[model samples]
Target: MTEVSRTRPTEIGLPGPTPRDMLRSMRFISREPLAFLGRMAAEHGDTVAFPIPGPPVLLVNDPADVQRVLRTGGRSWSKQTVQYAAFARVTGPGLLAADGPTWLAHRRVAAPAFHHERIEALGGLVGEAVDDAVAARLRTPAFASGDVADLAELCHHVGLDVVGRTLFSVDLTGQAAELLRTTGSAAELVVRQGRSLVSTLAWAPTPTNLRLLAARRRLARATAGLVAQRRDAVGPGAASYGDDLLGLLLDSDLTDEQVGDELVTMVIAGHETVASALSWTLMLLAEHPAAQDRLRAEVAAAGEVSFLRHREALPFTRAVVDEALRLFPPAWVVSRRAREDDHLAGRDVPAGTLAIISPWLVQRRAEDWPDPEAFDPGRFADGATQRPAYLPFGAGPRLCIGRELALAEMVVVLARLLGEFRVSLPPGYVRPAPETLAAVQPEGGMPLVVTRA
Candidate 1:
């Protein structure tokens, strides 16, 4: 009997996918990953290998296999050098890219800020932000020739405003331009410099590496400024918003510097994912007006007072967001490393192997979904799915802490936007689907027509 160990092959049973073929597939997958993965799974079966160098890459398509790898089999995996190598450029040791007890500890400390009860309390802030965004949207040329604006960008502003009020008690409306520039530049640096091992080398400092360092410094400065303002706001006998993320962290064991890193991490996590989700939802709604119509009717029935206040009453709006997340999850791919030799979907996995389980592929599998490409929010009616697949916030114990908050934010924005305005994608929009190291975002921007309903 052969005993599997660390030195043994980490993954097996993936018929025969060469490292080169896997790399070539990666290029095409980068463009249309969902379709590409569907083709690969069909051609190569359940388990397929991608050519990522260092170790063999395993692409798990089965939901059961995905569950095994993420939960029961997670101990055999790690966040590893690959994911951290890039994200560490900005977040440092924050939970997103950290591994082991450190990540767990940070998650524990940060958990209070996003708990369901705490999130429900933030509805007031979310509502205020939505109101501001709506005002700005109405100011657009909807009265004249009906100019199209970027719904995703509008959502980003909304997310930023929400994060600002709820996290730091600072309104980001005035600082949004600078904030956007800093985050956008940081993302570009990660994409360019964080991809290769040579760039991440600490011993040799290159121009790219220097740029990454500078980006982090700028981000820290901005974060620190916000923190200082909040810390000063702690007055005598004043009721503090200690439950908000920033307030919670301010009371945590993390130092101001550490707090800054985590704050930036939260800002990006709190904004980008929700913003992309909102953008994708609008895009899908534009493509499927019937779903939008149903949502509008539901919101109207729920009451036109305000969407964020009536979150509990708008089931159809929630369904629309859920379906959008299924079809186009912002965090579409889950990547991890095997710490020990393991078997996935009857395939033997060697230690140190990188595994990618994609919701983008799983949610729309023909076996799991009927007419998978079609936009149908009715499929997710009543907060249920036809299959065990569809994990927009991820799965297992490591599921996203901000899941409820993101959902609430999305529902509020969707209900409000659809309640007051009719949406349509601009002619020949042809925007490329999102490509990023973290959340998905359309390549250029998402432009949509907004007319008073």
Candidate 2:
């Protein structure tokens, strides 16, 4: 009874863990989610149908199937799942959690700002913001005095600065600490909501939901201030609101509430997601000297950090980024609810079944990544990242619109930082445990020692 099986359930015709296994898994699911999910999939075959109270919850692990569910088309699969419904509590019906035709139209209007070429054009602005954030956030007296720095914290600050400058044309660094804290609190509450069927009544004045209410209120105010500030800066009757992403949104026909929702999405996604990626990449680099040296050397040889100009020249540095993303994808698990009866992975999934497609599982599959645990950048040296098993950004219609911007932002931050700072783990350093949040974040923060390279 303790052993997991690959055999299909006679009733449903799908393979999964038994009810007993589910009961025992609760002890570690909160702490070792990735390990737990990986083992369940490996033992139970591609789709592991977990027995949740309300509906059938399946972890879709097969690469082809994960893509298929995501690309299922029309209203067949939606963000009505627990995870996204919880996320929408904080983000409103923004791009991250929105669905249907209106979401499609919003995507079209916002797509141009995230285009590869447009992100490339923002490279200089990005580089400036990175330098400014590093100077202000990382070069503190503590770091100057030879104390180890919580580099993950600094990455959040820097990521916020760059996102604000390049996308919104605002200076959010002054408010970074408070804003980051508010967003972080909201993310934790959202995760809690996703895990429990009881928490789905978001309107209930339960303590957890009450705290989420506070966080969302603060976020709404912050978003309004951003919109109002942009209006004031551009002034009335100006020819344009300026060409930044925020400007495009402001010029669009989206209502005030719609604009606020989109801004909240960008603020959280842009800062928290990129910060998590940069933090993990730095942690990986600090552990691999040869790889770090090669990346730094590439930046040194190129004489520039702009991806627009040096993307072709810095293959290894970019590979380091790709490999790091492979190891620690920010948006780890994407969930969807079946809108109607449908077949999936050779099984009849009933309408409203909760299906989770995790990037963590897909990226770490041994079939796609040989020695999936190793931090080898050479796997991507060829610069081909269109692998089906890799959905660091979720697949199909809901694929992250900010993919180009996130990649460019990461390259700029890593290239510029490694260009000057020699980063390494301090003596007696222990790797932090990964926590599932808005991203796969280091439990505490990634602390590392750095000096001039």
Candidate 3:
């Protein structure tokens, strides 16, 4: 990970794992990130600092401190950490990976497409996508054959379809399989790169690198094709096409390559992330039948699950999605490179040090979350999903721009699906372990027994 830490900081000033523990941390992070992070916080408290030679590595597990690191750091903190480096291989310089002025510039061009009123208008669009998903995918003959359905795959298709209409103003069902495959492949490859840095060598022709390259090319091709088709249909040099992400980008000053990168970023961030959230929520609902039934009961009215209706309609369903995000939090861990010395949880962190804050850790802190390990949607029952220590979509300056869109999508999906199907875990089925790829998803996808509601 490249950072501006040109010089090493003197003296380790914070509580953390010993040198021996650091070595073991490497193994644990590769094997089980959540467990390793939990162990670290349990042993060293919220603001644990690693005694590394270069800069300093600190774990800011406290919620308030996590907020400070993300919100107050401003330009003092950069996203040039190891995590973003791996993700940038596939995302290029898109908004997710971009920083400082570049991020601001890209966000400016992209913001209009995701404006409040615009996303609010997405209710009908999201409804259409979910309606199609239910009819075309879930209501098929195979699902009726008593075979468990992989709702993760279905969620991906639902997410892609929603993105297609909302972002590109067209249906993406035909390309859903390829789009899902490439993005999923890229996410897995990113995890490989994160685990062992050698996978980062894209030119080496290593198996993971070769596959990653192919995935990137495929994603790039998909984005390019969509952008080209949209632009051509709109006629050359035309400023306005329609009210969508592609339309907004076509009017921006960004180059074609930059436009493609942004589109790919949105698809991955907007689709894969949302799919993971929905999948995890479904997994939780599957395990807790009462919650599932309650969600179904809440959304009994077809007119209740509108996009921006989160405040009014389907409150229990909203709480279910909120608690699911609190537990799974698709983007489990986010990192930052401190440009200068800073403080988190009252501990001094040297400049260039990597600050790792996992929403999984902070949100799960028993202090903030009583009985943190339990799966309870009652935590957010008051129609309040935001508060201290909940960094699902993150906090402050770099909070996900698609936060509202993602929430809207997840609520619509949960409300509609629960209203139609009754899902339960297969008999004697082992709960799939959480696998951290592009997102923390159920290993092998979420397969559940589905029956009509």
Q: Give the top-scoring candidate (TM-score).
A: 2
Candidate 1 lDDT over residue span 221-244, tens digit each: 889998888777785554653677
TM-score against native, each model: 0.88, 0.94, 0.93
Task: Report residue 107 deviation for candidate 1 (angstroms).
Answer: 1.6
Worst 10 residues of 3 by lDDT: 1-10
Predictions: Cα RMSD each: 5.2, 2.2, 4.2
Candidate with the larger lDDT of 2 and 3: 2
On residues 1-453, what C-alpha lDDT tens digit does candidate 2 reach at each position?
234534457346777767777777776676667777788788777888776666678888888888778887446888776787888899998888888887898887788778667777888877888788778756766457345788898888888888788788888888888889999999888887776533467677899889988998998898899989989988998777767788888888898788888888898888889999999999999999999998888888888555654547788888888999999999888888888998888888898888877798889989889999999999998888888888787778788888878887788888888887888989998999888888889999998987777
Candidate 1: what lDDT? 0.74
Off by over 4 Å in 3: 1-10, 195-205, 301-305
Candidate order (TM-score): 2, 3, 1
Tens digits of per-residue lDDT, candidate 3, 1-453, equal: 111122222266567766655664576668887777777677667776776667777777877777777886457788887777778888898998888888899989888888889999888889889889888877776558446888988898899999899988988999998888888888888877865422255577788778877888998899899888987898976758677888888788898899988988988888988998999899899899999888787778646555786757777788888898889999888888888887666566678878888888888888888999898888987877668789888888788988889898889887778777888989888988988887888888899988887
